[model samples]
Target chain A: MPKKADNSGSAGSEETLLDAAGVKRAMDHLCREIAGALPGDCPVAIIGLRSRGDELAARLIERLAEGGRGDLLHGTLDITLYRDDVSKRMIQPQVRATVIDFDLDDACVVLVDDVLHTGRTIRAAMDALMDYGRPAAVRLAVLVDRGGREMPICPDFVGKTLKLSPSDSRRVYLDLAETDGADRVYLK
Target chain B: MADKTTTTAVRRRSGRSSGFVWGRKHLLGLEDLEPAELLHVLDTAAGFKSVSTRSIKKVPALRGKVVVNLFFEDSTRTRTSFTLSAQRLSADVIDFTGKSSSVNKGETLVDTARNIEAMGVDIMVLRHAAAGAPHLLARKVGCSVVNAGDGAHEHPTQGLLDLFTIREIKKKVEGLTVAIVGDIAHSRVARSNIFALRKLGARIILVGPRTLVPDQMRQLGAEISHDLDAVLPACDVVNMLRIQFERLQSAAFPSVEEYSRLFGLHAERLRLARPDLLVLHPGPINRGLELDSAVADGPHSGILRQVTNGLAVRMAVLYLVHQAALAVNGK
Candidate 1:
């Protein structure tokens, strides 16, 4: 169910574009749920798919730290070339660096993404992740789990679940006070 | 069944074992190689190394085979080594550079390869600027595929020669620490070395700037470090890599001087290594950038030894892959 916009902060104020505080709260809740699910002292690492997911992973790291959990390994992954539909794209996509500081062998990896939809991107991300090292298990975590999975996939922890029409496009925007004035999401 | 028996009988009658021979095919990447298969290629290469040392210098192993050097990129050392190796094994060599060929005339890579294969070329020695070009060509063509060097991908022959060179210098690969320094991100040599060295049981340390070394390299079981001093003392074989300036359009670093100061192997740095630490490079060295000339041509330098072993290793690779192809074809 889509949670009602919490109006405590600027989300209810006239300056509202989208809810930055609301997104943070939801991300924090999702992270706590994931942290609780992990076994004791089991080496856990979070690999964020590049671009927005990488930023999401970094933000999640800070939230995890606030909850007194500082033992998780963090990494950023690039899956541009590994996509099955790469050749069919009109423009040659930009390739980014994959940064996994630790070996994935036997480590429980939580693959964090900003949004989950058709499941195609997640599949490519998983393939790209495997080239680096074999993880014992991989779980998916998304901020928004919009229900339109074309492939056999489910998110382990989801911040919010949204139902959308087949033609509708949903976009998530993350902004630093340093880049843009605030953070938000929009649907068109 | 009769055709298969006849082909086997013909192979036996030729006084060559119906099992395998070296010059009739190509030697692509090592992605599909098992430990025993890799050993077979190495041991066969050792025999060819002996043949390379003989006075006659020529072998009839691939007398009628056509070995085309389809290099789509510029490479003096690797191209020359492959050409010489093919000639030594009595295969007719066709060397094509990208600029002078039909590749410049808007022809696709597969079309060009097919045109050459039409000329009865038995093996193709390919070197392209894109990773996986050889594998793509191998899938399209009926002839054998030998990858000379694909873009930051794999140089299997170079890797084999490096393995051969390391084995010759240290006499064993089982427990040695091999450090590959410089431009790890854009190096096919490093890619191949990782696979070859690991398969042979050597520990690998990849030392370079964080920008040049991919973070995923740790997944391949290599320890990544930016500080050369930290890794230098522990390495048994210091394999220096060439920093191809032509490939670098913009400076990956602030300056060459900064790179030299941080990562370049100078005389003082060499002194910190073990007394017997064998220094190596897949040559055309950028003297001051990745390595100092003093260390490159120094007493312990095995850079030239790597070049020499290139001939023997290529000869062995050609011989073994050809044998495997013949065995599969029932000849």
Candidate 2:
């Protein structure tokens, strides 16, 4: 998932990278890839990062259920309190509730997010998830993976790999119908 | 400060906007907080309410932060609630009391705070017998300051927890009449609650003998009443403040027994109130005086829940102030 505001500004040249149909195809492909990788009949905890990430996770759960994996656990992780750069930001992100009702112990946890850029959010999410309980395995899934990594972390599942400028001045946004009222991927 | 401007620009450029930005490094009182700010603290506390129920019961939000409890006044619940709240957020807590500390030797409050901050303390929760003690320290110290209680001034966290408990039990604060009964003039809790509840659109009735709750308190936008039973029927919530014998300069009332008979919330008085009237007490209660044992422990009581919510409110305050301080200092 791209770091939010990684290249924040008026889109230098705003363009739609993926429309609704393209988003659907990417999601379907990503779902199949995730289903094929997980062990059959294993109860996977489909946890999403807060804000748009949780929206994506909910959609992912519904998609997985349609594929006959109805035993997946749903959870939402709020990484606002876990971010390493809390003091560096001007406006403090609203700290929302992290609703993980089911036990994470020995369960397969799939962490979901919309964009992966600096990998800091995923780092924070992992730290937060570990506080609840240790899982049998934890995997990362994202809708968009734009280049530029500050941490040595990689995602196990990715919907689209976008190649933007290495200068980090371009923004990547994945808007879903659940949150933004439209499914579209755009570059700014 | 320069970093904030640049980062704020960056944040705006990123196309993400948060409606509220907590800008204060210290929470001295509820008197100055806007309605939205009051709701922000309550909402944040609501988010933290679930953290205490977890198996680990700890979060790394303040993992490396240090919080000092500097109490110039005696308190068991507020002090312990703050300590536990800091610990639950994984912050290192140092408890400094007025009796055992250098303040006993006539060391000024500023000197004590500066010395503690020199040791890299991130936040200081202060309780003093003097009003504006925390405010004075807030000006002198670079670290964040939280007012646990100050003489007849405001216990912001206590006010917040009361609001939290009210909102929890009643599902809202607006359009509800809350009667804050007993020791209003000498009660920092009553002062804080009046500011908070009034800001959130809840009508307030300050009930006590005229001596303890003066007529001048009406300027704070609360109806003053000497009759508890008269006010009880209209109140959706009743907060019973402890009768501070230590704070009284002279006899404000005739006697404890007389005051109990007139204003005490026993079974008889309780029956006069609404069936679902939420009862709250900032504890170390004069058990039979302000509240009876039955009512304090009864079904309508949010007394225990207030204590539980106290921790969450304090945690939210500490975490917010620490973040504000860090954002300002960029450390």
Candidate 3:
């Protein structure tokens, strides 16, 4: 859930587009939309991009359960080492496991993430997913769509679309099973 | 101020919820590493081992990074392995040997290193004839330094790979009796193995001639045993270190007959050891001089596994050093 905190005396101005309650409702709606269009005949793998994406994917799976498709295949991917601009980054890329147990030969993969910005993350996910096996189709889903796309890629399902400028920040603070406990998407 | 750098990473697929943190600007030797740090390298290498099995055995971990191999000494095996390991991680590698480089034209080591660093190399893999040569280079260069082999000081990766091989086969390091046989006094591999194995909780016994196994070997926490047969039964693993004839001064051991008869691991001695005994060599093996051809090729041998694990071990070292360098510079 997204809980936007108030910053009355900060240097920069802020806006709370959606709070924690709003995020849960948005996620519910997004899952309903994804459930309606997903191909039922084939094996649909709900793959989440690693770290925060896995958290978002877990929430999505819970929401999808309400729509009666809880049995959908799930996996998590780490595209850190797979990134094209790895050497350019000063920080060491933390490599985690990439678990895709089911065969992707003819599966429909719903790639999930928390925020959509440069669209480069999605592209890297696509490239990494290719190395496992060619999926029949791949549809992307995200909670917040802060549209500043550098790539030709776009999300299939977006919960909230915020057209923020370059200077504005969209920090999607998350509380996942594996990370520090907190969840909110603060736009400033 | 913190660099506020981000890696753009994903969830931990390593069955853990947290990221791995490693901090150390350079991997000077295993002697400097804590037990946890050494184990971490082995664990990290475990994740990278599967890369070799992939159809495209390349990972973009170090992609676009420049790695320089500066060697005052010639080492085809070590150099080639480092190149392949770096390339497998998608890093562009530059090779510079003493014979081919300007060092032959009277350029100082520091001058040579500064010039290479100016070319924007992110890491330097150095092997020099002098002990602590890489340590000097590490101090001089701003980039992360990996001591490939610095005379007799340490050949860290080689030691780690041997450790990796042992862990790979035996499944544990603690409570294992590992005997290091041959050229203890002159072998850099011995000096490194002593540090690594002793730190990892292995019972190490140095087995060779009295002249070859110096009194100083006891300081590394390894028992000095001149008789290979007496130690064979107690040892779970026997590492036959290469007899570096080039490094030897006059006649340290009486003769090949005397040395081989006393220390060589041949078939007759194999029956005396535990049935599950493992044999290891750091390679460029003197088959007849140290261990017989049968033992080197037998099922009990992890010599070839040592070679394969060498690649993973080196990859782990390179990746960890880069990670360390990032933490230091970023902070």
Candidate 4:
């Protein structure tokens, strides 16, 4: 099956990229792509990069279960101590737990996130993951791929490639079912 | 020197609002911190302790940040611990001692700090001979300042690390009878510990010679004790402070011989204390002076654990302050 075009509806300056239903569809599609792309089923893992990334990974796991591939393990990488820009950032980031119960050795890993921006977060997540063990292969899976590349990295599996103006507030507001009472994605 | 328009940005709470907000810009002393703020640092430290147990010990929370360890005095343990903490957080660290820096070439502390900050330094880990040196630099520089050890005033991180180590072993700080033994007058660690223990609802006994353990410290809320054996049986944890004989030249005690005979913590003295009593020391121990050689290496000694916990504690301090500064001046 070929990769379909990004189904982002045309909104000039700033718009809602994905609502609750849109997010579920994009997530279901991405999970299928990830399940197919990853080789072997024994040592497969899905890692979400803290906060909303973990939520996305949970949904991805649910989708994988529905597709009859439920053995894939999942974890979260809290890159509070691993960030490269601590001195330059405006706020002191918290060090969340990097909860990987399964081994990373020779595993086919899919690193998940809600939105992809400067690629620094993924970069940090990669550095942290390698510290655990050498994975056989690592893939980047993101729901929203906002193309403003600061580092030479891109998502291996992207849900929607939404381009925005330079001045478009590059913030993705996501509410998870785990914390907030609803599931939604907003770009403001 | 006062030409730079530096704003006095006190350390605020970091983002994500964990158990509590660590609201203090410069970690100069534990005396100024609320019990809740002190607990926040220790709790934050608890989170980082797991990182060291991992196969990969580095964290990227401070990747792009720069931490400069500015030491005016010579120290190996505190300096190395601070360096490792910064490195573990994935932050760029620069070790700047007074001997190597332009301060020897007549450059003032404020000037030296401004010069470093000019080069995009974010946090300053300072250890100075003069008291309140970090406080002076904190006001002058925009970067977050952490006093690794400032004269005889306070080694705040050391105090917090001690608390963490004690809690790790005893599981509580409240209602514990902690006797701090050794040079109370010239020891910053003693002052820091005294204040921290008082805040966490622990009963502290200041144990040393009358010259070292003055009654004035009683104002700090610690019980002034001249006799160690008298307070030994009632104590839960005994923190033996390092004897800074080099820093004190007035012959506070009659001799090294007399000091050891009077207050030296040996196996015999340890027997007088509670069976489950914990012994602690902030390193560079004088073998037979402050403590017996047996007790220094004894099972009750939390000395080694204190050293190990210092790394995580320092990491937590560096991370919390770095994050707090960022919350104030968003990236």
| Top model number, DockQ | 2
Model 1: how many Å of interface RMSD?
A: 25.4
Residue-level lDDT tens digits of model 1 in A137-175: 999988877667777988998887766554443233344
TM-scores for all candidates: the values are 0.60, 0.93, 0.78, 0.75
Against the true structure, whose TM-score is highest? 2
CAPRI grade, predicted model 3: incorrect
Candidate 3, residues B1-331, lDDT tens digits: the string is: 1123212232222222234467777888888888888888888787677666555578878887899999889798999999999999889999989999899899999899999999999899999989988888888889999999988889999999999999989999999999999988888898888899989889999999888898888988999998998899999999998888898888888888878888998998899999999999988988788889999999899988988888888888898888778667753
Best-to-worst order by TM-score is 2, 3, 4, 1
* Backbone clashes in model 3, listed as residue pairs: A2-A20, A50-B10, A50-B11, A51-B10, A51-B11, A97-B13, A175-A182
Q: Which of 1 and 2 is ahead in lDDT?
A: 2
**Candidate 3 C-alpha lDDT tens digits along A1-188:** 12223333242444566676777776777787798888888998899887678877877887787778867889888777666544343444445567777788899999998778778888888877887788899999987788878799988987777766554433433344446444456643
Candidate 3's C-alpha runs over 4 A off are A1-76, A83-93, A97-120, A141-188, B1-20
CA deviation > 4 Å runs, candidate 1: A1-188, B1-26
Clashing pairs in 2: A1-A115, A1-A116, A1-A117, A2-A115, A2-A116, A2-A117, A8-B13, A8-B14, A9-B13
TM-score of 3: 0.78
- Give a tens-digit lDDT track for model 2, residues B5-97: 545654543333355778789999999999999988888887887788877788888998899999988889899999999999999999999
DockQ of predictions, in order shown: 0.01, 0.46, 0.19, 0.23
